[model samples]
Target: MSTLHLQQLPLPDAEVYFIPHFIPAPESDVYFGRLVQEVNWQQESIKLFGRQLPMPRLTAWYGDKSYTYSGLENKPQPWLPVLQELREKVEQASGQKYNSVLLNLYRTGQDSMGWHADDELELGQQPSIASLSFGGERRFAFKHRTRKDLKPAPLILSHGSLLLMQGPTQHHWLHHVPKTARAVQPRINLTFRYVRG
Candidate 1:
């Protein structure tokens, strides 16, 4: 059995849990190296206001289904053995079956993700997302969709950490990784999801 202990984050109207050491340091280092060398990382782009701008980070999609996000339709590549291994661990911990994973490589502190919720219809209602982080620690935050009265919760996503978000979390919250001015090592993040037909 997995020895992972999940700690629930303090936030209303959302179910978020964090595991700071889902993967041990030595194992995380190996996985990080393998992913950076083996995965076909691509510099994807987004069209905003009809202007095509390259995304801040390199990404890859792997699994059994096609998914669309940020106006980009991603045709998934077959899962790598490394990815399949990781997915199994995530599934065992979260008690959710995931057929797809979206990976992001932040080459520097400047590479970031904007505020968005994983509410895509293909993911079905009450989607369970298991996010795994390997490499440098980064700041992650979640803000309420409408309740300005509540403060945004910020967190440090450390290496080998796993974050699980489920239930009504996406329905009421938006999250993002903000760019920082500090110098930091590269970070790889994988969000595992279950896509419905």
Candidate 2:
């Protein structure tokens, strides 16, 4: 395995690292296929404005502890073999030990995530999150939490790419994957994080 080179993002009050091609093409293809078949994906509903609406994408949670966010409590599923393997690699690359992972599947161009920070109380302060992407390329954007003058920075998260968000990133910024009008294939994202005991 080649050493992953990290590129630091130029942003105030944030510590973010971008590593493109964290996994090789052949391995990434295999991992994507296996995970698609093995993961028990579900469409979850979110409560918005007194209405329950299904999320735009499929999701699964795996870890040793439960997590709660946005009025949803996610019970951890036992780690799958393939997920454990990938987690080990991610830990080695990010130098962070994570006990849980959240997987999101974007099936097409319309599937998206709204701007939000991963600053849940269960994640503790200054959490480190390692996000790995596979299958299709999508735009990942970040905007300052309070500064309206700062322009949102957009990044193309390609297949086999890895992005690490740490330090004060979550406290100062919010990120999201926006929907696009262009045709797109399925994309899978795995975000590894630690849950405070």
Candidate 3:
């Protein structure tokens, strides 16, 4: 286990904590390999503009209850052992208990998430989301919700890193992993959240 260090990122109207190397390299490798094989990764399609289209990345949901987003309802898959283990670590680090997690697998540089906030009604008014990254490094950017003058700040989400977003972060900012042209390896991201019943 590595010494936990929280690095605060300066963003307007948001509270974010970046922890580089949250999991050691050896442990990260094990988790990454197991997750790739154990997780039920699926490329789900969503209804957009009255047309169905595949999501850019593969995703899986695991938790105590179902979650709905982007007009799609995600039935909870029972948590795997490895996921449960990681969840405990994340909860300890962030000091927040999460009952659900949304896992995203970016198979290549072309796979990405669009700009959006995790502000669904099920997440309550303010939610604390703990995102853990493994495998390849990717660019994570944040744009101010109402401020057009503010430039988007890009952060490098390296393997074995953990980012904790809390407070008014989701309410005032939109974040995403943009598509890239450069060659990149697969990456897995797990975002732990506490969904309201």
Q: Candidate 3 lDDT, tens digit per residue, 1-197? A: 22478888999899999998899999999999999999999999998899999999999999998999999999999999999999999998988899999999999999999999999999988899999999999999999999999999899999999999999999999999999999988999999999998
lDDT of 1 by residue, 121-190 (tens): 9999899999999999999999999999998999999999999999899999999999999999999999
Candidate 3: where is the Cα deviation over 4 Å?
Answer: 1-3
Against the hidden true structure, what lDDT does model 1 obtain? 0.95
Ranking by TM-score: 1, 2, 3
**lDDT score of residue 171 within candidate 2:** 99
lDDT of 2 by residue, 22-68 (tens): 99989999999999999999999999999999999999999999998
Worst 10 residues of 1 by lDDT: 1-10
Clashes of 3: 0
TM-score of each: 0.98, 0.98, 0.97
- The models' CA-based lDDT, in order, is 0.95, 0.94, 0.95
lDDT of 2: 0.94
Candidate 2 lDDT for residue 52: 99
Which 10-residue window of candidate 2 scores lowest in summed lDDT?
Answer: 1-10
Q: Show pairs that collide, candidate 2.
A: none
Better of 1 and 3 by TM-score: 1
- Candidate 1 matches the true fold with a TM-score of 0.98
